[model samples]
Target: MPSSPALLRLDPTACGLPRRSLLLAPLGALAGGCTPGAPALQGGWVGTHPERGHRLRGELPRTDGPLKKAGVLIVGAGIAGLACARELARRGIDDIALLDLEDEAGGNSRAHALGGSLCPLGAHYLPLPGPEAHEVNELLHALGLAREQFGRTVWDERHLCHSPQERLFIDGPEGGYWHEGVLPPPDGAVALAQYRHFSALVAQAQRELGFAMPTQRARWTAGHAALDAQTFAAWLGAQALTDPQLRWYLDYCCRDDFGAGADTVSAWAGLHYFASRHGFHAPGDEAGEREPVLTWPEGNGWLSQRLAAPLRERIHTGRVVMRVTEGRTGVELMAWNEAAGAPERWQARAVVMATPLFIAHRLLASPPDALRAAAGHLRYAPWLTANLLLREPLLTRPGAPPAWDNVRYGATALGYVDARHQTLDPMPRPPLLTAYRALPTAARGELLSGSWQHWAQSVIGDLAATHPDLPGKVERIDLCRFGHAMSMPVPGLRGSAALAALNAARGRVVFAHADLAGYSVFEEAYTAGVAAAARLSL
Candidate 1:
């Protein structure tokens, strides 16, 4: 396990986790290294050891140890990697090993601690799985989060996101006020009219052009292709739905899930956000309801930890894949062991490149056209999650009380999630707010170059409006940055022929990652891993 910041040494009471949970809660955080970009700050980076990942672009470290052998070697150890291993095991293929660059598994869906509280460092929340996501549905059932009762799906109420699920702080003449939901209030008659039109459009989309969560589940037609060929913003413009508030809300939704707003992502992605999960709803509509999500203080890290627990002995961390070579006999992988400070080699009959498509492209000795093209067309979004420990609750505004998901209107940042919102205890001690910001591709440089203090201050300032005294209440702030957080489903990327080819590829090395899906989501990544494992000849 990586050493977390010493700021959380106050006591366990500050954390909402119970005593038994304190013992049983699986926590694996990435270690931080001093960088040229570093200076003295109260908080530091906690995710994606940037140094280790960036090392791939530089020179080599020669191998020193004897070659390690395995029946199968799976790289990544993320949600996809872990799922691959689990599926392979279920098939009675036990002779396998998993490796990751970071000291811990869970890639983007990892956990960290702040002021004794377990908080999400990256991706959080798992929405209710749709019918076509059989793999995910099974996993939820196995984990006791959901079950089929009398031919109807039933969830464990405890795991479902508590009511008052989300809210948006809308700017007004009176500063800003909290709205019950992330959607804008549709302030004017024109906006309201546009809202109803959009709602009907969503219904039309569901009826005429079907949408599904896993995407693979839905049938791809000319209608889907047309939507994929243009940007969401372009599509919106063509519809004559030029309402500012509606556009802002649409942009916010795009940024939240796909990492880019309407101008960047394809039209299919924007519509899929609402149409696939639940149709767009205006206030007073009979179907107006929020989608239930499963969350904990540590977010999806809760699920990741459980997925990783069963295979602890077989998992290896801090092993950066140097090169991958496939031969007539088997596959050869050279990995650099970070902790041991030595190079190691692995000989495996089968290898799964369960990493981002770009990373896999860099690793392979001879890459296929499909893999190369897929990697070439892809663009990853830079993500930043800052977990701030609050000494006390923030001052609440009118409307709904505090919510699990809090967003600020017209803000570039996605806003923050209250880590303690789901706590069963009525007593208050301290709470951690996990603030998320998905930056544009251009800002990747600044994200990597900026000091932890600079970014921490920026995050605090961004949220300061919602809580005027936030600066005073915060005890510590720990920020995590991912350079290639997720693949943005830009126009034409989803229906690209190259992705189809890569998904169909079979041999000694099988590719698996969210990148293969042209977008990042738990369902896509998890299913991709399982599919990859199934393709294994073993």
Candidate 2:
């Protein structure tokens, strides 16, 4: 579908900028002509390597080279792959090789450099690990980001999100005002009651129906399965929690974490968003506190980088895994080495497919019934992240001070995070802003279609709703696209019996990706990886 001009504030008379052909359509179909103005926008896709992986869709050339051998082989170098390798190393399994399609590891957790600053390309933060996410806690403790002080786990203060943590741009009588947090404040008596009511509901969900990070650890009950059967919007409607502001914030949160809205994701996912980690907080709740998250300028890429550091010697990048065949002797893997432009064969006693379920479907010579069922039940969201290099500071709106995470009311995009927020330097020299937009399942075709310019313009237009002067201040903009970004936790996905069987599979070719958990997150990926490695009898 051709996109109409989206979120662009048109003012051709003021700046002489063209407006007609703004957001969508590329082949001159609905739109094909327009000069990008104000400041020359220079950017192309970064991080994700679709071209390399897309080769698997065609008839792959047979392997013609000498065989490479590893005691244990991992097919991805993302968090899961890396964690699996580390776990294998811990288990005294030293012969390991990780083949990745991208030139760099980190998958969606990758980062990009823009001008003098480093900004995130995908996932931006990690909330403090909960009790069940022991692997993540162990990783943090090993990284020195957290430590035991007086028998209590204390996180490094420098790594936590700085004060003025979040702000929401809301329309007001005078003009638009920035609220102190992402949640909308009570506008009236009814809204206040609704806010408190939602908070209580989240508490009830947490208390009765348990939720946990790496969600698989949570005890799934009939109540949870009932919630998992319907969309979050329907559940909210049943509760009669229909305040527009409250809905907008809830939808925003769904988009932020799950890459979709409440209407699309399951009710279980919606409540789990609040219940799993931090319970919802009303305005005046004394027990309320903003959940602290570990973040860096480069976001979770920081963690990925450290995870990849020690395993650098074992990791092979730019290798497009084409086929995986299991014979009576061992597992044979064929990969197209993108750099060499040749196909190579490798054999291992055991293989860990740390890639997504869909990719695993493509790679396996004969995918099992469980893998087929799991892939069939899952759907993925296409994500776009743009890093804007600004020449000057953005004009502030009224209300709260500038914060790290800045969001607009009823925005199509999730929001922008200031890269300079964590900086120790007090001097203000205009910082880079990383904007995130999670597109709908319908938009996956448009997102994958080559048009970084149009997508960049769309993101700029999305931000223009709040920062009108942003288009002029942007020095450079680089966009990153993830075609099958994160698995959308639609109704029935979280409760799929196939996932349970797949997760517990102890086989020669092990599946270890976020898809086993029905969605993508650091904890799930890491835990899946560690668990997969543990199941490997090699």
Candidate 3:
């Protein structure tokens, strides 16, 4: 077994800059690489390859009695499995099969439509990758969106989102948007500036090569990976970054990415959140528009539907895999076929466990030591997304520009995004905006088992605090709570030896999950899917 890059620490000074850092000031900017295009509304890239629906080897043989066989059997039809399928199919392998407990292909990125508007069940946005992401660019062009500017003002095509994106509802008044224009209190102003400074510093480090190591083991950097082996709390204290400004930034970042705040996450994992985004745009430099995200009337399910188009007939829904055993001859999967109420078996050359870590911990037989270690290290947080249908558009303080995402300062969780934002023209009725709650790990058991009415009332009450008239304007309230909506990069989890082990594939079983990547973002999912495919192909 090779030493994982997670454990490496080379000389940072040799790369230039300061002694503690690697590479001096980027050697005069290196031409700023390729410019990324504006973010599009499309999924960015979907089925662009020549072998969009190509399969590997042959379809799994249908059996009258019980068992079936294939070259590679992938579990979970999420992005990871689909990416693997696409890669393998392109390589002239057509005998692969994929299965998932859910009927769709995208795991968390799935969406559903309500009242003619599509709302997200899990993920919605995919940020622009760095300029060096050639493969992503290729995929985008192939998807027919290479030149399209998403979210651009159709009339002018020169501006984007009209500037101010997000505004905060604070102390009975709007505290302005996240950047300029919105007015914040003195402390808020100070905190926001400091936060920006810190973000800029982190971005600088990320732009450099030493800290941006992509390989499995640590690269030519001096900083110890073990330094990240502590909770964000410990790391912050050690670095003396406990000022209110720094704290607020960390708290907001944690909430946005992991659905938890700083104290709940690992410092290393938190750093990974900022360091990993390397999105790119073309025909221009950093001044170009962001890569637009593709969305369905049902949110990301639009992309899922496209990816699953070719494999729709081959999919077997409700097949809950109970366990997997790797025998001398082949791998056998023991599953409870939910549709027929019978236990079924499957044999294949390779298997992809695309399910969440929590599920994988119990389903695979004699799991590799790394997987066991990861199972023990990984922790997931539950979520509650409350969708409220309003009879009237709740009025806010005048001059407070209405945007998609609305947040409340010092709230229980981040606020909600108007699911109807994508629809430009006016509508006869007010649509639903989903209020998402990142319930603390300590509150999971109670929240999950609570009554629906109880949860709905609580959510309404919370929203009412900000929009006093919102409750009365609401016509219908629909509640959807996911017990394990996301994975938390718990403090000390990132640099742990166990994590490195779990990330490593054992024999024919390849592991892929948002949790394994440290950051739970859409791009990470895409990268994970692509990485899993490359590994399997090798």
Candidate 4:
């Protein structure tokens, strides 16, 4: 793991995890470079990461009293803040306080229980960590999750992802690993070849372990950053890898990773999807395939809950911090105490603002002009995920057997993950699978204002393209929209000075967000949080 700053080192009370526990959290942004003429919309003219506001069930309570005098004040209850708080608590430094605008601590990791299944409100899955990704390993181990219990990583048949891992519904039939025996004829062969070729290229990039020049803050291998200079479309064009079928696959990959199409994501970011991964088990553990990613029905919210366990009592929710100014006394956090229904202040020697960059912009109280300029250039893509409860298993399209992540080859974003996939109960009435659809910003205007019925109808309509009776089978539809889900990793966004400037802390006031990490992945959030904490510890 990269060296985190000092602020993250403060220790909390004995009731929580060790400071070391803070070091590992689940395990787990953009720049604008344009020529003088107001650059043309290079790729798809779409906002990549947008937000879907959280629906507060009731009015929040406000607080006026000082929770506690602390050496550190961490803002936001999302994974980043929780992880930081957990780490600080473990450190034996009890003088700490955490605040968030939401009444809950998970932030985007929030979930809802519906029809016997849990649905994720924000992030869903975490990629297994690489060898260098020590932070994740530490976190998992700290959480009491032993690699041995996971069965040596090859995903033993018992622990292995069950029979139907994935499937694609084409025309009228199904084709995927679940239906490996039912491979589609020659046409299927063509698509497979395309996938093979692209996979090979990504694999080659991995072998090379490419690193960006100067090597300071590349998201993945340096090699991946070099690829950032080109758009995925341009990269594909160079491969002469253009076929309508292949295009759909590429689009699916981009939609899954960037919440947009291949044409929109930077080629480097797309390659990182495959290349940055180095999945291998122990020496003797038939590690043919990488470790099977472990997830709960509500996706990453499960992990967030696990991490929050140790800090439940310390977290202050619905407290929107509006400003952070350092003084001779320490750091002053000017914030709104939701519970008390009034503006309140907090004092700490150091503070970490773990909220999103856009939110931080307001809290920082007049950031450097460059940071402000970059914040303006950065764009977030909004996403809407629908977790539908089905009355019964919908008819499989002849050859396709539904698996965990059922993705439509050329349809809306990547399809849904079967919530019951992880459940042991093999009864006929299994839990319903939730479909997560990411609507493009252009479509956001239409989707956001629409009712749940409208969104549910849209989801069923799209699935109907392949599964004719899908709409009738759905018993309930739960909707959660992440308005600013993630930042788009565009070409110029990779190395923009503006993003770098936002990360710069002008004395006492520090910035923290998964966005500042420049990549919206679990590790990025955890690492960024720790980094902010480390800086304060100094």
Best by lDDT: 2
lDDT of each: 0.83, 0.85, 0.57, 0.59
| Candidates, ranked, lDDT | 2, 1, 4, 3
- After TM-score superposition, the amount by which residue 248's alpha carbon in candidate 1 deviates from its true location, in angstroms, is 0.5
Q: Which residue runs of candidate 4 sit more than 4 Å off their true CA positions?
A: 1-69, 148-161, 173-196, 209-226, 278-291, 500-507
Encode model 3's per-residue lDDT on 56-80: one tens digit a residue: 1234323333888888888877766
What tens digits encode model 4's per-residue C-alpha lDDT throughout 248-331? 666776677677777777887677665566421222234334435656667788778887777777787766665666676577
- Tell how far residue 238 is off in model 2, in angstroms: 0.7
Return whichever of 3 and 4 wins on TM-score: 4
Off by over 4 Å in 3: 1-65, 132-136, 147-164, 172-193, 207-227, 238-246, 278-297, 426-429
- Over the stretch 133-175, how does candidate 2's per-residue lDDT look in tens digits? 9999999999999999899999899999999899887754444
lDDT by residue (1-538, candidate 1, tens digit) is: 1111111112121133332333232221001111223222357888778889887898767866668988999999999999999999998898989999998899899999877778898888998988888999999999999888899989999988887899987655444567778887765666778899999998999899898878877888899999999999999999998987789899998998999999999999989888888889986688887878998888999999999999898899999998999999899999899898889999999999999999999999999888889888999999999998776677667766888999987778899988888878778766689999999889999999998866776776666646655655666789999999999999989899999887887878898898888999999999999999978765
Name the weakest run of 10 consecutive residues (lDDT summed) in model 4: 25-34
